[model samples]
Target chain A: MMGISEYFESARIAYQAIIANKTRAFLTSLGIVIGIFFVIMMGWFLDGLDNAFDKTINAIGTDMLYVDKWSWGGSDDWRSVQKRKPISYQQALEASKKMTTAELVAPHASKWGGKITYQGNTLGSVSIVGVTAPFVNTPIGNLKEGRFFSETEDVHSVEVVILGYKVANAFFPDRSPLGEIMRINGRKFLVIGVVNKRGTIITDFIDNQVFIPIQTFMGMFGTARRGVQIAVKAGSQELLDEVREETRVIARQVRNLQPGEEDDFTINESQMFRDEISTLRLYVWGIGIGLTGLSFFVGIIGIMNIMFVSVTERTKEIGIRKALGAKNRSIMWQFLVESSTLCLFGAFIGFLLCATVIFAITSAFPDVDFLTPYVPLHLLFIASIVSIIVGIFAGLIPAYRASRLDPVEALRYE
Target chain B: MNNDIIINIEDVAKTYQMGAETVHALRSVSLQIRKNEYIAIMGPSGSGKSTMMNIVGCLDTPTKGTYLFENENVATMNDNELADIRNRKIGFVFQTFNLLARASTLKNVELPLVYAGVKKDERQQRAFAALESVGLQDRTHHKPNELSGGQRQRVAIARALVTKPSIILADEPTGNLDSKTGVEIMRLFGELWKNGNTVILVTHEEDIARHAHRIVRIRDGMIESDTINPSPAEV
Candidate 1:
């Protein structure tokens, strides 16, 4: 093995050679720059997606299960699910009362495509969700301002509402919406609270929904025909499966299904959202890796071709060094250093470009939840390591060829 | 091999396979040299003088017979071993000067030491001393392209001498210079020889070969004459 000083000398020689041919070095490393840029951007995007997905799934409450007419995650046939009878508000209430392992149960009945108006401003295609006072204990039900409606207000059907974060922001940009009276379907309701910003790309509609008491909703729009979904939160994460099983039994009892009959309603959990996100992430990664691999392959070819040219151009120098007592390993190290330095330069440039783009995007849309403001530090580390590996792989053949040159013939080369 | 003999060659031959035919570059040659002897090997083109130089410098091994440098068999040495021997024991001066065009005169001279894993401070000091010996001390930072042909050859000489090798091997060292510049280089070789450094000159020019104390002539891959010059030509 050569000493560290010898390696440094080889690296010094390599640096001089690259500087002597600046244009060729830059052009040769262009492929590496673009490849690394694509790789870093893809990594940043996927990490943002994962982080946002985790936050949104947590907002949906991982320990909670939903008993609804429709199955989530596309697990059941749509036609069959639609043909099943809907869970009534009374049945939901009964099931909630019977669920022993649940921490709290919030029965929800939603009316979509409803309009909410404040002064001259109006938001179209908003969802109006009706739930009891216990909904405040759920994850998405956490308030950003003011307080949730009391059980007294819900029982008395006092027409109090909680606005979603975006709805509040749109309606009262200059002032708080806590005491403002808003009209939902032309009926007046005082805003008592504002839900926190808890929406991701998968569940962005949560931001456009307004919450009201269940009794008020049933009074305005008759209760017999509308279906209700029950949100059941487990006492602890460890009791989720037990709560789910108990909820299923309560639901079956509420619906009065025969022993042999399969329960009509579906019990959906946040795990369904996680599973879907993972599958989507797999596809994204598949395409991202495929594209990144292709670019790197092209980059490797570019560097290898240029290294071969460099070796040929410096044949006489190789001979001279060999004659000066340089071993084959020394020559190999010289070219390897040159190639890796080129790749490292390219990676720096690529990382800068990626950072600039990410900075521009995140600054432009500061409210965006799924785009991070800066690239992660670990991704930079990964890119540098990957670039060096690529450089070594690309420079291997050319370096070996340079090391094996016949000193006499190489010196004879013009 | 005698203790005083720095190089010993016995029935050494080299051949090249040219397609289906084998070309005999050297046919059964033998020679010996003491540690401080100054000699020149002279021949026409393809007369095996170049082959002898290659074998003596450890750049190429004999295909037959044996060659011993400092009592070590050169014929059976591996490439790395040959490289090590060349690094420590043989200094080569080429017809073209062969200085790295991009490197300064100092760096070009420091190349051998760099490969030998010498520390930077000592390498620079030694390389500077070598440049001073060749009267290129002031041009240490000048590149080969920036220097004259004679100056470039001096830099190459400085590089050759940096390692303080067992022998200085010059193959047509003045082949690329003008007559005056060529004479100046031969004078430098004479001074080195007078200072007790072993010098071997490989040249087709009689004027250059006459500078040495002894001359050996070859023809058709075999030595024709080996004679001492009673009084060497004045530099």
Candidate 2:
């Protein structure tokens, strides 16, 4: 424990030592500064990208489990497990009735090329989906205007349609699309609703899409006999695993699979999309943290080299102090303080550079909503600890050398 | 008659164990100095006068003898005790002026107080006062390089005196100075003696030696002679 004035005096000596040789001090701090700068900047950039990814995934739906023929997330396997025939629309209807954990089960049917037209104004062709009333509630798709078609309308095989918000905006910019007549794939359909501006979770929220009742869709453009997937919805996260298990068992029963055999279909959470984003996040962190660590290592090495020079240059000074009753530990502490101060200064500069870069990038890209300018306190904490650790580690050799210098030889040194 | 003994050496010796050889730097030297004794320790090169000074200043332990400083056996003292004695009882002025190169004059003079863990205000006041005593108060902020040889030596002297230690052990204090500067520095030491602090000067200069009340001469790791001056300088 040092008294305040003495502590400040020691710090002043360290400061003066660096000031006397500014160029050397800056050069020594260069590696560390660059290392941390790039690392922190990369971290912020990746965080922004991950935010974009999560928003894209969330646009599709929450709670809706995508039970398809393939695994839900990104995969490494080159070949898809030989395309198990797609789950049938009947099987989706059957599971909807059977699973106690399910809130709603939307039997979906779809095709990619559907040209939509409202009078003389024609919107571009898009992937049209045929779905149940439950889909609007389960995935919680937004309704920008009017309402989604009624379940009774699907039961009656009504020729009704719901336009995605983008389609409504593009083809009918000023007019209310509800109660208007539209044409889908040359078939007449009445516009019942316009879906709300989509969440930034999946795809470009402005991409054109149209939804019609599954019953009318099949009647109008014959069913493929095999549906792509039966989307299931769980009540809550607490029921997620349980609902998934029950859905799997029910799907097996509907598909007529016996016990002890693998089922034909896959059941997984909508969250799998976010998990893919997470694994990618891990890689981002890995690269960022590893690079930062490398810079820290390089910075510490530079500090160590300088400490050696400092100890040797001041060998006689250390000797004189020892002659005047300074202990080995005191000499060690002096050099440690010097080394630590250098590292702390470098860390402060590096963090500032990182923070500035983050701010600049966000300002440059205003639409990038994920950019957060405020650096987390944890990063500052980490930088401080790094500085202190570097001080102790880098100062060790010089401190030892200084402490071991014999008073007699030191005094004799010219 | 018995007087207060500040430094007592009894058959002290120092041997350096170099590779494949032993160099005898000190051999059975015995002497005593009471309080406030102004003495000059003089000898040729390799004569162990520096070695004797080191032992007297408690900077080194003797190889085969006892050194008692004010009745505390220095031979049995720990490093902390030696440091305590150095800071509290014996001040040192070196030949090279040994001021920390990057520090200011005030800081150089405050080094001992720093070791003594003195408060910053008191250290500054004391160091300033010591510099004033050496007639260097105006140059208190100047670094060694900015000062002349005489000024740097004054700063060194201020540092030596700032601790208010009993003995000012000056090893060739004026070795780097001109003859005129040397006499001036000797005059400063004479004034310090007049103020009642013990001053030990280690030099080969007979003129510098004449400034002290007693002279101890060494030759080849042993005392050649010890004598008192017939007529000491009147202050």
Candidate 3:
């Protein structure tokens, strides 16, 4: 086995050679620098993407199941789903009462493009959602101020509303919005609560919505036309399948479907959304890895070419070392060390550049929290290990060629 | 003086194949060298003096002969074995000095010891001592390009002596230096010889050959004469 001292000696010689030819060494390392820079930045972007998706998915309750006429992720035959009977609020109320496994069942309905007005100030294109009191117990519903509508208000069809954070800020920027009366489509509604900022998940603008009691919404929008979505929360993760089965059975009975009859509603969970996100994530990863692989291949070829040149340039020096008692392995190790040092230098510069770019992007778009790139410690570790492996693979042939040179011929080389 | 034979060469021949024709570089040469002897192999260019030097230094194996270093046949040894012999038993000083141009004088002197796996502190101490013997201890930190030709040669000599090999083989040790510096280098060799090290000098210059106690003249791939110099030149 070669001693540690011998490796150090080889590294020392490699350092001297690099210092002696500064411009050559720098030029040779440029390819690796650029390649590693792209790889690290892409990795950081992917990390941020994963974090954003996870935050968005977690905001939608993981244990909750959505019962609706259509699947959460749209299916291929949407016309057939549209032809199926729209789920009604009565069926949701029936399922809530008949279900045995669900911890909470909240019925909800929505009307987009609604305008909310407080005196002369108007917030247009607002989403209006009608939900029961139990909707506040779900993950997506958290109050920053006041309280959600009571079960008495929901049953009595009281004109009570809960404002989203952004809506409240727009109408009453300097004062608390609780107890203020806001006009929703010319109907006076008392603001009983304010939803906390739930930042946009994919395309859903949760913070730009207003929530009202389902009975009041039915009075305004006419309950006979609109469909209601029933969100069922499982008591525990292990009971999710059982809760889903119970909800499906109750829904079927409410729809008066007999045995072997096709169901009129779709059962949805957060997992379906996660599966959709994963498909998109796989595409991003494929593109990122493909581009990174190409760049690394080019970088490795550049390193190999430069190492070959270095070996040829130092043929006479190799002969002198051999004459002084250097074994072939020592000569090989010297060249290998030189190449690896070059790669490490490039990787260091690449890391600095990547960090600078990430900093710039984050600072430039402070409002775009999802766009903030994250450089994890594991990514850095993997980058360094990859650089070393690339160095070894690129330097192998050139080092072997240097080691096999006949001392007599090499000494004679000019 | 102890008459212990250090190198024994018998009917050694070296041939090179050049495009279907074999060129005889050395034609059946036989020689023996002992400890503490200062001998010069003198010849013109292409006269096989270098081939003989390479064979004696264990850098190359002869084609058809028996060459022994301390009673071990060297012609049959592999490349790694030859390298070991060169590292531990024989040291070489080249015509051009051949010092690593970017390394310090101390680092150049420490090369052989590094290959021998010597610890850093001991390698440095022994390299310093070798430089001191060559009168170059003060120039230990200078690079080859920073030094004069004679100083570079001294550094090379220090490197050769650092390993404390049985024989010091120098091929035209003063070939690139001025006469005064050449005399200085020759006197350093004389000092090393007096200190009980075998010295083999290969040169074509008669004045340089006169510095040795014995001289062998070669021409046309054959030895023309081998004789002892009665009055060796003094430094």
Candidate 4:
């Protein structure tokens, strides 16, 4: 067995050899640096996406269900869904009257690509939603300024509207848009409230919309052409399944579908979104991990090449040490230590570079809640472990070759 | 004489395969070396003097017959055992003064003790003493490239002496130095031998071999003569 002192001597020799060829060591380790950087960045990106998804899902309400003619998951063929009868406001009213497990019910009608103007500024391609007062009770309904339209406003067809965050910002950059009158589809409507900024990467379109009472929307756009969506909030998270079944049965009865007949309405929930997001997450991780794996493989090859070159260059040194009473294990350890030390240097540089990039992004976009400011400690730990493993694998063949060298031939090598 | 013998060889042979032909590097040879004996092995190229030196140094196992080092059968020893024997019992000096090129003279001298698992402080102390014996105490901090050929050789000699081995085996120790520096190295070896250290010199030069008390000459893979110097040269 080689003693600890011998191992230390080997490490010292290995360090000297690396110091002697600083440029070669640095160049060889560059692959490792890039590999580690890509791995950590990829992890951070996926983690950010996950964080954004959680925030969006929570805001949308996990126990909420949307009753619509079309499924949000697109599981039903579009032609068949289009052929189904549109869900009408009357049907929504009937379903709400019959529901027992719902905490609140919001029946809404929305039109995309609508135009709104304030002063001389015109914002096109805005989503215009007509909803009841119960819509304000949802998580995304928190107001940043003023108040939501009241039930009296809906009954009287009052021209009061609530602007989403981005719309409010676009119309009034330096002041509040509440109580200000804005033209919607060429008619003057008072902005009663401003919804808080609730935009996430996956659900950003919600911030580009304005909401008004459903009666006013029917007076302007007419209710005969499009479908009405009924959003039902379960009394409790534990009652979501029961509420959904109740809504489904009520919606079928409102549509007057007989027993054994297929229901015309689709009930959508946050779980559908979660399932789709998870699949998307898998694809992201697969591609990200695959790409990082490729980079690490290339890094291994780079380190292996350098280790072979180092062994060949130091053949005489190996022979000298062997002749001076070094065992084969000692020679093997020397080369292994050299290669691993180089990889560790690369990992450290990679970590520093990654940290700088994260810091720059967080500093630049301080309000970007999706991007965490600091690299997670586990990422650093993983980078170190990955680098050490790469170093060992890369050095194995070359170190073995060095250890197996015949002392006589090595001593004679120039 | 039998009890004093530290190395014993009986009908040792070494063979090699060169492509399609078998080459007998050492056909058959037997020799014994006793304690504190200064001897030289002399031969031209291809005369198997290097093969003999390799066998004696425990760097290679003999293909046939028995060889003993202090009554231990070295021919049957495994690689680890042979390495241990070499580390503890024999010191090697090379013609090229094979010191680590990047290490200082002190580090070069400490190489053997490092392999021997000696503690750091004692290794340094003994290495320094060895360098002092070779009159290179002041040059211990210089790298091999910074030193003259003679000084590098002295450092190599210090490394060889640091282990306090049973025998100092030198292969053409002065072949790379000038005549004057070569004489200085030989004088140092003469003093080491006078201090009761066993020394073995492998060289082709008659002048360098004359510093040893006994001369063994080889020709065509066999010993041509083994004779005492009667009056060894005093360098």
Candidate 5:
């Protein structure tokens, strides 16, 4: 028997049958469409979340690594991290001078709950960070409207403040905020700059905080000798590891740590961001693949159901073909082609719908990565192959049943 | 004539289980039919004429004894083997004009070749030739439902004749048609037989039975008589 020719003929016949019942065929494809729709949508949502996090990381500056006595955010130890001593200015200065890889090193001092008042309008209980001019070059102090303060202001320990964009907007919406006088914790400070409208985890980055020169913050709010952390910049991402190691050695010396004692600080930068995203990606693929699988199952079910109906409805046809000379394999292939065609069509429609929805949502709120169109070629390719496999399996029992019918009995069938 | 018997039945019996009891559909029936010989089996309901026809068509296996087609014993044949002989050797035309209602006349005629795994061009050409023989060439593309009863029966005859099987087992092939349409269908069968094809017509009507050169009467699962019609029914 010419298997190829037979299969093609049978497939053509089967396709004709499906076309004859367009409403049923289209409805069946809908199941597959809905299934793929959700799966692709999940991909877009995941991408949006990833983009938001990436923006946050970029906002913190690529050049600067946070050198702190403990990791930022919550503690892994919880108890031990709470008991740790703060990084001192002398240790920071020593680490800065020793690390040849560092392009800029600025000691950071923390002053909590600093109030900012501009005339009658005021925002209270905001985090007030005090750091030197290094932040000016780093992305952390990048501005939209006004420039960062000069190194001279930082050295003089001048009473000056840089308002966050939202903070300035709240008080001086129509006017330039630069050179305006604001009081930080009841102390007069000349507004030197306003930051860009940066996004945040919860609060708007610009609206939530105030920035003052590190030296002036220590002199006025707390102790001049105190340092909370150091904002250290490695010249490039490649130099970060080397700069971190050298700073560790210098910090140990400055802290007078005995040999073999665990180093007191970690250099937190790109690696942390990578690690976080790596973990996040695992969760994304896990959930995404899982949910996608469920929809694919629905596609399979639709194919199976349709094929079963097709077998019965075309009983006489199958019988007639059998009488004519159809091999069992040819009959099987006919239904297989039919089912796979339906499902693959569904996948196409589903992805199209996903694209339309993505575009619509992104147009409404332009932050969405609408054009990303994350159709993993391999996954989709595999899904299509699997759909075909499922198509064959779904067609198998029915095709067999069809081919097994007695020609004479079927011809005699009512 | 090849004079070689293409089909032979030796004391073949078939019993069907109907709920509580087994009904002997055919009892010790033995017959031999040569290729290209027209014959008719005639009997009323419950006479087992249909059962005998089924055994001859390879639609059912016998309960006892041997059935042979072209020296190949059919009683011991597997489903696939029986199917092979059925598809290649025996064509069937039903009393009710059992054409595939949804398929075109060409497709209905091509049914056997499709099973035979014939190529598309060959299947279509063969079906067209068969339709042409039954004078259905113009209506080849029409569905069974779209055709009149006479036309539908002609399509079914075309389907039965398309495979060019050894014997055409037609069971009351014209029972569904009006008298004039039925006579027309029988005339077509006479033409098929004249063209050197073996035609086996099963009908209880004596006039229809008379159309065949030989008639075998079956009653109570037994062959009551076999005789040649002196003056057969005129087409």
Candidate 6:
């Protein structure tokens, strides 16, 4: 067993040798630099992706339940789901009245691929939603400007509409959108409010939409008995499961389904969407780790080759050290220290490059919340450990060879 | 000094297998060295002088022999034990000065003490003292590349003496130096011998061998003569 001082002495010698041959050491460490760069970049990107997913999930509300005719996640039996009767708006209102655990309920319907226009400017392929006043109280429907349509407007079928932030910006870039007249499907409506920006909540393009009172929407688009979705907010976060159960019961009662018969409607939560996202994240992590592993393997080979050359070049020095009474372990430790130092130097450079690239990308797309990569502390810790492990593995064979050299033969080597 | 035999060799032989051919480097050599004895082994090239030096310095094991260092059989010791023996007992100076080119003169002198697990302050003190003894104390921080040839050889000598080993084995210590520098190194060896340290010089030069009190001549892997120098040359 070597003492602490001996190991430090060996490290000092290794450091001097590396400094003496700076260009060769840098070239040998290039592979490690590229490998660590990819690893760090991948880790930062995954962290950013997780943050974005969490934001989207928060916007969609973990404590709310969505009751709809079709499930949010894809089902195997499409024909059976299609055979069920549509969830009418009347049924939504009936279920809300009978629900015991819900704090509020709103009925919603939407149409897509329609154009909206103000004066000569037109926004194409915009989504148009119709909902009751209580819809604004849900997680993603907060108003950024103006007021929501009143209950009287919804009851009387008045043509008052609320625009999303993106829609409002397109129509009125310099002025407030309140009381502006916009044409939807060639029908004129008064804008009452604008929904706050909720950047890409799940798969929904919530910002590229406009909302109108349900009664006015039915009158303008002609309701053909199509299903409407019912969104219910639990009384509190603790009562979410209880509220979902009560909602299922109340919805079954409103739909007049028999006790033994399965309900045709499905209830969904943010967790379901999050689970699907997790599956995609797993695949990304696997591919990222595999590619990085391959690069690290190549880096280890490069370091090993360079260490062999170094041992050959320092044969006479090794002999001198041995003749001076250095043990085999001492010689081995010196080379190992040299290789690890090279790897750590490369890792530092990799971290700098990764940080710079992430900064450039985030700056270029300021509006994209998911594009801002973040380097977590755990990622840096793991990279340092991996670099050290690679160094030891790469330096093993060469250091052993050096330690086993015969002093007589080494001294004779030119 | 009392007649205490520090090295005892009996029928020590060494053989090497170069490819398929076996070459006998040392053939049944037996000799005894006492404390504080200054001896020179002289031979032509390929006369087994180097092989003898390697064996005596504990750098190599004899193929067949009973060699005792301080009455302990060194031929049976393992690599680590031999390394310990070499660390505490034997000092080696080579023809090329063999100092670490990148390390400072002090660090080169401190190398053996580092392997011995000595503390830093003590190691430095001893290394500085060794450099002072060789008249190179002012050159302690200078690297081997920055020093002249003679100064580099002084650093090597200081390194050899740092551990205060029982024996100093010098192999053509001045082979790379001019005649004047060579004599200066020989006088340094003479001073060390006067200080009661055993010095063994291996060389092919007659003038270098004349500095020793005893001279042993080897021819074709066998000792031809071992005799006391009637009047040794003074450096």
Checking candidate 3 for backbone clashes, the offending pairs are none
Task: Assess chain B of each prediction and give its TM-score.
Answer: 0.98, 0.95, 0.97, 0.98, 0.96, 0.98
| Tens-digit per-residue lDDT, A243-354, candidate 6 | 9889988999999999899889889777777677777778878877887888788889999999999999999988888888788888898899888888887787788888
Which is superior by lDDT, 1 or 2? 1
Per-residue lDDT of B94 in model 6: 85
iRMSD for every model: 0.9, 1.8, 0.9, 1.0, 3.0, 0.8
What candidate 3 gets wrong by more than 4 Å, as runs, is A172-175, A200-204, B1-3
Residue B63's lDDT in candidate 6: 97
Using TM-score as the measure, which candidate wins? 1
What is the C-alpha lDDT profile of model 5 across A187-253, one tens digit per residue?
Answer: 8888878887666542244346778888888777675444477777787877877877777777788
Question: lDDT per residue, candidate 1, B1-235, as tens digits?
Answer: 3798999999988999999999999998888888888899999998988888888888889999998899999899987888898899899999999999888999999989988889999999999999999999999999899999999999999899999999999999999999999989999998898888999999999989888889999888888998997888878
Supply the TM-score for candidate 6: 0.91
- Recovered fraction of real interface contacts per model: 0.77, 0.52, 0.68, 0.64, 0.41, 0.73
User: Highest DockQ, which number?
Assistant: 1
Q: How big is the positional error of residue A202 in model 1, measured in Å on the Cα after superposition?
A: 1.8
lDDT by residue (B86-154, candidate 3, tens digit) is 999888898899988888999999999998989999999999999998888899898899999998998
Q: Which model, 5 or 6, shows the larger lDDT?
A: 6
User: How do the predictions measure up, each by TM-score?
Assistant: 0.96, 0.87, 0.95, 0.89, 0.76, 0.91
Tens digits of lDDT, candidate 2, B76-186: 887667877887888898888888887889988898888888988898999999999999999877878999998888898898999898789999998999989987888
Stretches > 4 Å off in candidate 2: A1-6, A45-64, A74-82, A110-127, A143-146, A153-210, A216-221, A225-228, A271-278, A360-374, B1-3, B77-81
Candidate 2 structure lDDT: 0.79
Q: Could you tell me the C-alpha RMSD of candidate 6 in Å?
A: 2.9
- What share of the reference contacts is kept in model 2? 0.52
